[model samples]
Target: MKYLLVREDEDGVEQLWGRCAGVDGLFVDPVPLPREVLTLRGCGPDGILGDVLAGPDVSLRSLGDLCVEVWDDEQPVQWWTLVDAVVVAHQPHAADPALYDIVLGAGVRKDESFVELSAPSRFELSGGTTAAAARPSRCSAVDGLFESRDDPAPVPMELIGCEAVEPLLVGTQQPRRWARDWAELLVLDRHGGVMASRVVGLAIDGARPSVLGDGLEDITLTDGGDGRPSPAVRPVWEKWCQGPPSEPNVWAAYDAQGRAEWLELSTRAWRVPAPRPDRSGGEYHVDGRFVTDVPGLHCAIAEALLGPGRYFGREWNAFEDCLAGGFGVIPPFTLIWHDSEVARRALEDGAKDAGERLPYFEGVVRLLERRGVTVLLR
Candidate 1:
């Protein structure tokens, strides 16, 4: 958990850079920047080098016990370490020893792959800037920088520790994070056959569906416009509306917690007919319903059974393939919704020009159910 902060001083010389402490309460001194260190200048102005460093085309090397935090003034820009990384290849430039590129697996995921970094130039921290320098080539303070100290500063080490937080904490962009969320949803479906299944978009949120766990509240259901549900939902909704008023229904199993969640409803305003009874047949009303939230266990079934894809429109059955082993069995995924019910209806009814994929929406749900998903409908 020790961090080595790296930054440029006012004169652009490397000073004791980090807020990290030694045995006593003083700031840790700058060590010889690791030869493995990747620099901003190496990334080039267009960020071509940075992209090369992050791209999947490279290999990984070992990340030793140390972690590095880079700062632009007081604000941190990047944090990384050589610890736990895989070293695939190292290419040193024949023209300059300091100008080289090394490829290493960058993140903490088991399947995490490689990113390459080019040290285009020797780091600017080369010469001794002080009067005590004996050898003019190297910094005279280099020895003092590495020496462990026991002298206490004005503040306690504990106080410093509390104030200076580690900057290298992993983020959502990490493959590990994406895999974790995707796996959580698949596991819920595997254990409890899709606790909640509803198409979300259009009247609800007017966007494609994505897999949202704790983010369900972010997609608030809308209660405006002609309340008619999207065509993708109209057929089933029409069938359900034919019976008694569709009571606030809930289907929950695995992650079922009794909390209120919002849902968009598009139906005939039977309880309160339009006052004028307009002959234009625009009586549909879109409203929101509060149901006991359970999709967290079942992955929060607000709407949008499938999320849209990268190249095309909404991919309703993409989740099926994802569960069936798309996205590396656990790739990054998000909730998506269809633009309109008509679009989904066409996909479902196999309309020639409008749809091409066979509609197996119910069958897919059943498949997950058979695998152990407990479907609770209320």
Candidate 2:
């Protein structure tokens, strides 16, 4: 199995980044998104005030990617990526379960998504930097930067096989690198076709090559898995990484975070543009046999809506977004949920809404129904 690192040229042409000689942590479970703290100095009980923190919005109310929204009156001035916060008991001033003196830490500043804006005097902390998202960008980066480095300073990638793509190779760099830090790694077919892409963040460490016959040295193939499905989910990607799968439904082989990782890969692999508004009233089927957890339900739905390696939604908020329009199906569509009992038994009223508990399967049905989707359970 040969692994080639690639990126797009200025004209969107596939440029060879490198022929991978070795990879370190490529096949791993998705890592837990690192958590960051958001501190709101006591503004004397304002609206929606508290140490609201959690990484990646796993709920319906999440603004964008589980980011905590910074408000300017009725409107959301900015949406900052947030995670759960730890208590600071060491600081006597940082008493009160919800209070902290720390202001504008590394997490918020490093975020390029939001620009630093003056928080209308009151919103700014002592450092006078407020993390605010003007309008939550509803976009995902394919290759982190996804753009070519204009005068990139020997981006941290190194690989062999330069003889094949001499034209695409940049000036004078030996053992060329084909991708940026957040570059997407694709599994190519024997005939050099795009099979799977965009699930892995291939970071080049640029180390001295050793016994790596085909090993692309100095590259870490994940977000280090933090708490997400890093190594555990490697099995799901191993075969696909080697070559394109013989068929679909291959993602159903794993469960828990592994299944979720499969869905993530599928969402990228079988991705397609949503049909126009007039293309409504189509009938889709959900393979509910493996509907064991929240991620399982997503796998079933994505396969149902788009095909085998396709996607509709991965979470509640994303599901609702798909229901609105443009995730392969329009409103007034039909959803034939096959093997309904599997999900009904496995799913509990587990999803929380302030206080109300709703079963995920039922929630999906209700949301679909409300969106004019006639869900026919079988």
- By lDDT, the best candidate is 2
Instruction: Report the lDDT tens digits of candidate 2 across residue range 99-183.
Output: 3232222223222324344442233211100111211212111111111223212212233322223432332233245333443
Q: List where candidate 2 sits over 4 angstroms from the true fold.
A: 8-14, 27-66, 71-79, 84-110, 118-184, 189-191, 196-229, 242-249, 272-284, 353-357
The TM-scores of all predictions, comma-separated, are 0.15, 0.60
lDDT (C-alpha) at residue 67 in model 2: 44
How does each model score on lDDT? Answer: 0.24, 0.48
Locate the minimum summed-lDDT window of 10 residues in model 2. Answer: 125-134
Instruction: Return the lDDT, model 1, position 291.
Output: 16
lDDT of 2 at 336: 95
Off by over 4 Å in 1: 1-61, 73-77, 81-83, 108-378
- Judged by lDDT against the true structure, how good is candidate 1? 0.24
